[model samples]
Target chain A: MADTTWLTLAPAFLLGLTGLLVLYVDSIGRSTKGPIAVLSLLGSLAVAGVAIALPDALGLGPAGWSFVSFTLLGMFALALFVQPGSQNRRLIAGLSTAGAVGALGVAAAFLFTFDGEPVNPFGDALVVDGMSLLFAVIVASVTAMVTVASYNYIAEHSYQAEYYALVLLAGTGMTLMASANSLVTVFVALELASLPSYALVAFLKENKGSVEAGLKYFLVGALSSAVFAYGVSLVYGATGSLQLTAVQNAITGEFTGMLGMGVVMVVGGIAFKTASVPFHFWAPEAYEGAPAPISAFLSSASKAAGFVIAFRVFTEAFLQVSESAGEFLVLGADWVLVFQILAVVTMTLGNLAAVTQDKVKRMLAYSSVGHAGYVLMSLAALSGGGATATAKIEAGQFVLAGGMMHLFVYGFMNTGAFLFIALAEYWDVGRTFEDFTGLGRQAPVASVAMTVFMFSLAGLPPFGGFLSKYLLFGATVNSGFVWLAAVAIVNSAVSLYYYSKLVKALWFDERPDDKKPLEISSRPVGLYAAVIFAAVVTTAMYGVFGPVSDAAIEAAAALL
Target chain B: MAVDTSYYLILSAAVFCTGLFGILTRRNALLFLMSVELMLNAANINLVAFSQYYGNLTGQVFALFTMALAAAEVAVGIGIILVLYRNFEDVDVAEAATMRW
Candidate 1:
């Protein structure tokens, strides 16, 4: 751990390498589809198999199993999309190769990272630990799914290599964001993640909706990042350092007005990234208009990256300091109350807006915002400082872990829902509740997968979402924020109404009599595989909740 | 004599507000990008001023980084605006709103 171990950097490098290779091969106009497909199949199988078998040999314990699960799931998703005979065979082959390579990166991340032992590869500027790797798993897995699904989603599109390369690049950026421990790294990584995403959102340049969504997304993103940069400068002015630990030590007494402004601006910037209230405007338009897999990627993986930074900065830089002595709660209580209010308003507004939406995509967008509110509970729970940082750590770990676990679970269930949309889009199945009618009879398997996603997203009992939601609220109550927990519970109940609408539309409603659709063409193999893979993870998460929760709690403990 | 840090702070604040005003008032997509650049540069000024004040290179280095990042953002922004104009036949952001905000 002390030596300069470059082992941890391999995963991100591999992803970037694959992305470049795809672009290079495409530029050179090589039709290496047969070999590419063969290599991807063999590579995915080998990585998955090797990771599963080596966990015991290497004594990775529970963490190894976690790594194995990611590898297996990623390979399984890739395995499904390996079929041949598509018009965009080279595109599909190249993308699948990139995805399998991404999975290989996840395996590398797991192999290098051990449980309870955090690795700092580039000093404190970057960390290779439970929190970062957990997020890496989420981002990389979602990227894998998106790459596979986009095989069909953008099948005939001309810029196939660019599409996959941008995705892998963005995935690399999100992974870096999780590990960034300095403001400089954080800012750079944010842009690295976002720039490619703008192009991806507007990938379908011919479509006005896609173009418009990209413009709005770019405008908002540029504005927010400027705000964020100014905020970082303010913090630097107040504290005289960019490092989190230095900033933590610098914030000794009451927050100066400068520091206060810095904190608010910083939070504002992060809010836009997570699609929270007041900054969530682009989410609906972007998600509704862009190809659905990108929507899935941004909502699940990108959002998790934002929260990981929030967790890191607040814990390492802000929350650890301001310890109280005897009389009362101290400097830690200030921004926390602000966070609490934001959480309540964001969750409530997101759900209420979702209820009024007629378009399913827009509704999912708002629900993503609502879920952001739920994850915000982690920050909200660090309400007061203890006598020492250790005391604060103890008080915050359970509640913080709740949000972490929720994000982990949310990554699966939410991505599944959006990928279902991708599947429907692939079929040119119409949008909206009515459009979904009788389609359940058409594609029973994908519909059932969608049902699992909806049920899980609604936090129904016996589903994966329920456990994570329960843990989040339960920890909030334990943190003495019973009111926050109450609001969250009520929101969950209201959310059920909308989530079930999709189910009812799929099953109970009759297909419209007048418009008889033509017979279907060949199946969208990639979309179905990705959707089902997500669905399987959504359900299968239940069996391994114990290890997942432990890992999340362990991860949160390091930051707190 | 070196000017006080507060003077630089005030200058940057004024620049930031002006940029914010342009963003609020302008409809042109290119103008919006220009406004964002002004805002980002306002931060760059703060960073460079703070580095001088703190006697450290971190802020100065980040300022350099900020410059690069701004240029990169502008490049992406221009590409997006070009597409917007191609699709909507206008560079105004208002014209680009096919979906209800």
Candidate 2:
């Protein structure tokens, strides 16, 4: 047990050490770039090797190591291919990628090797289990992809090392959040992840839009966190415990108004992170104004982390309160009903708003909001009536698995789409509908890859998005929420209109006579490789849905 | 008459609302950040009050963590505001609306 405990923490520790080492190397002001990059690459590979060597007793199984290794290997490649910039920029980016890779490797190792049963390490402050592992892998993959894609996006920027370090640090915080078993850990982990992201959004000090994006994002994030902390206090006051399971046990009796209010506030705070409606006002501006790779990181990895933590707290802790009450109600309100309403309104508003946007980045941002709604539908489905506790548990697993699968698929498709936007930026194309005109003729490979991402995002067949959505809708229907599924399907259809608009712009719109065919100034091999890899994984995901779904089901079953 | 947990709760709630109001109404970026800090401190008040009532150290420890987090947030917030000031020559929240739907 002692050995497993230390082994489980080794990956994160190693990654953190790498980050500090890179900063140290930078501070010394010697010829440090080459050494820093080499150190980072080696550190990532070592983390991967450690992840695989961990014992089964450690709870990270083979499946977990595979995912962790895959992410780290990708990061290693990113570090290799990221063209060195003048001076220390390349070293900084390399170190950041390495740190992210190392952190993700640790998360994967801990999550996969985690026993099917939950373990409360750190005196119940942290839980290592299937759900956390699943989300950890998703978050790590997104971080790795974004770091690789950013190699070219931020190549010209001066503060390369800081940028990469912040990215990796944010990723570490996310992984910690996924495993956090107590409210205290949750709050700390959340801030750890968020602080770095706030800096990353405003990385381009000279760019007005970047600065504004950082400020708005930071304000919203701070507000939500404060609200969340208040809720935690209220929960502690009501239940006298910060451990999630202990809280669950404490709240199973007649729910007090205070507990009810606290739960609502907590959910409200999380809503800001997921970019759900009523709190989604910041997402569009933030995504539109930040650098393209940072946008991808926030929209994909950061959002996934929010959803995972929400899933852990809501399902593991709060879901029981509603269940033990012997009704679908909690403190004068049906919690499921609230989620149901939230799901419908969020998707409808997001799609309608997206349809009116001209800027591609802003439109994608709104579409992401719509996707959040679809995932929320799975949460709502968790409350379906069942004849027995076992039946309810089974249904919960299906619904949770559906949500997990959709998020997994989304990490690739959405990141791929944003990386394409980065590619356009590299080609000096503007970030508008008109900017993509004649892209198909000019950059055939990139245009085709972008089209694939668009199609997948629109939930077209033979792509990962369609299958994931199908599972999500099917989960809802099986749980007897047919109307909710209907709403989701309609939202999916509405989403197609805007996604197809981008595709049409790429193919049918005429190129201006004055504009020359866009050319890649510096061949950003890392950017292209990341986009193509995401696109291929998305396209190929159709063939592996069976195994993926089974794995998700196994992970979900472990939760119950 | 001694103060009770409810009094603390009410006080914090009022403070939280005031902070929210300030955030919604304030136009200066610095003021917005201050309002956010106010909101965070209100939560800290709740944490301390709960800790005293419950006789558990968890709430107090959490409050300390919250303070550290708030400090980190403020530092980052100030840095961003400085950058915003540099670019726009002002810190008015209204002027930061460069990208809107």
Candidate 3:
């Protein structure tokens, strides 16, 4: 933890550079996007290198700070933005690079973190721990990839500069949210991430659906924030504490009804952000309405941030209270049952709705919701002995770790799918199922990549998605939640129908009259190659699960 | 003299519920947005009350941040509404179903 200051300075520096990049690009009149992008990407990568070096110098353990992982992921994701292109190329490159670097720095904080242990806080408003660091890495990695993917995706637009800036800002907000130690920090970070997203959702202003989607997202998001703050207030009133860890000491092992209500309201609010069932109403429209790249960011980075924060807040802090402290109390039993029900409904509804969607983005959005349900089921494994039951809660931690892995894998596959859609849509419109017919005949590379993403999402073997899903569901079953795992299995099966339909359309159906050999004219083939590389590595590494699984398990152990 | 905490909570809850009802029942997008603002303000009131009761500066600071965020949200919210209104001539949530159920 000696060099922990670098973790904070790295992101702060990147954020500052972004403003400078914008100013530089503005001064250059209009054509300097390319150089600015390359410079920014290199700068981000350098910061990431600094982060990686920090771990070696300061060592990992508790001192490496989670921000290191975040910074590295940011560096990797920025690789997508620095692609060679003419469509506001410099600005996209610069912002995307800065965003990635920012994410990496944030993740590094956990590796070099010097905070107290789980359920015990040390930071002013941010709690630095393995759970938060794991999430920081997840958010940074996915954000980097999505930002890179978006570079080519939004190349032709005039407002590309603004788009990249907002995306970067959004990413910075998400990282802050992940490391937030207190409810007050959580709210500020949540809004920081969300407000930018509303604008990004409506970035395609000419599209009516985009405008409406943005409005819907904004209103619902504001409402959820309000509801969440209210729940925080009630918890403050009941426990007389705002620090998540402090809630443990304040709850007098009384007021079961009030406790249950507080937990439910808070869960409901976070659920909206994660797009869990019932609150998942806006995901599909927003995805379909927004540009393809933005859709990728939403489903990947944003979703991961939601789950990570939700997991830490619920399982780490509240779970123990519900189980041990609430013994012979109403809150413990009622809240557990409610979470169980939510898991079932969310997964079931998401999969069923996905099966009916014709638009690929919309279908993926629903699938994303289903994924949230699967993640939520991990909460069912919490032991409720508060911090004291750490020994007995290994099963819950395993499930939680598995959920985290799934989020990481899904971020890659989901965003890659959207990238394919964007690449195809840019050349030819209509993202409906019919439009994908004979895609294999036209753009063989994209079609095949799309197939890989689809199969991966369906949880087929030889893919990272399959391994993650197995880990999660297996852990769920191990935690004595076989029924919940069974539901997840069925949901994954239901998901296959829609996902495979895309594959079938790509390979089997007749080529549409408008189907022409699409040109890979935009960012060269190198960018697509990177996307494919990520997909391949994700799939190929599944066979060697010893290290990956170990890493995840070790990460989860830090939380409990 | 200390003010009753429950009274403030109940009032906040009442206003929040009213906003929830408006969002659910009302068709107009403008009214829907107004309802959301009301909900946000309700949360703000709760924060202030808790701040006073607990004597915590953090609550008041957080309330201030929430207000700033709410303003930004409203700005973006209204911008989108204008875009929708220009495109459809009506800002009714029910009418904006080009994407479908």
Identify the candidate with maximal lDDT. Answer: 1
Tens-digit lDDT track for model 2 on A1-560?
32344345444454455554454445434453456556665666676677667635257664455446546644543454322233466676676667667766776666555656765554588876776667777777788788888888887776665667677768777777878888888888888789989999998888888899998998888889988988888888887788988887777445477777777778877788888866788899888888889889888888888888778787666765334544433332355677788889998988999999999988999999999999988778877747766667677789889998999899999999988988887778888788788888877788888999999998999799999998998888888789999999998899999999999999998877766666655568879988998899899997767766777888777665
Residue A324, model 2: Cα distance from true site in angstroms = 11
Give one digit per residue, the lDDT tens place, for model 2 in B3-97.
89889989999999999999889998888888888888888898888888878888889899999999989999999999999999999988877
Pairs that clash in candidate 1: none
TM-score of chain B of each: 0.97, 0.95, 0.95
lDDT of 1 by residue, A1-560 (tens): 21334457556656655664454445333354545544554565576466555545566543444445445444433333322234445564556556545655664348345556777765677777788877777777788888878878887777676678788878878888888889998899999899999999998889998898899999999999999999999888888898987887777554487787888888888888888866778888888888888999899988999988888877777664343532223233367877888899899998998999878888999899899999898789775334555555566888888998898889888998998888887777777777788777788898899999899988988788999998988888877778888999999989999999989988888877765652456578888888888889889887867876888788877776
Error of 2 at A521 (Å): 4.9
For every candidate structure, what is the RMSD over all alpha carbons to the true structure, in angstroms?
A: 7.6, 6.1, 6.8
* Candidate 2: regions farther than 4 A off: A9-11, A28-86, A99-115, A252-255, A321-333, A512-517, A520-522
Model 2 — TM-score against the truth? Answer: 0.88
lDDT of 3 by residue, A73-123 (tens): 445334434322234465556566656756566655544452435422325
Worst ten in a row by lDDT for model 1 chain B = B92-101
Q: Where is model 3 more than 4 Å wrong at Cα?
A: A1-24, A27-88, A91-95, A98-122, A321-333, A384-391, A512-530, A543-548
Interface RMSD of each: 0.6, 1.2, 1.6
Q: Which regions of candidate 1 deviate over 4 angstroms? A: A1-4, A30-88, A91-115, A321-333, A384-392, A513-519
Every model's DockQ:
0.81, 0.77, 0.60
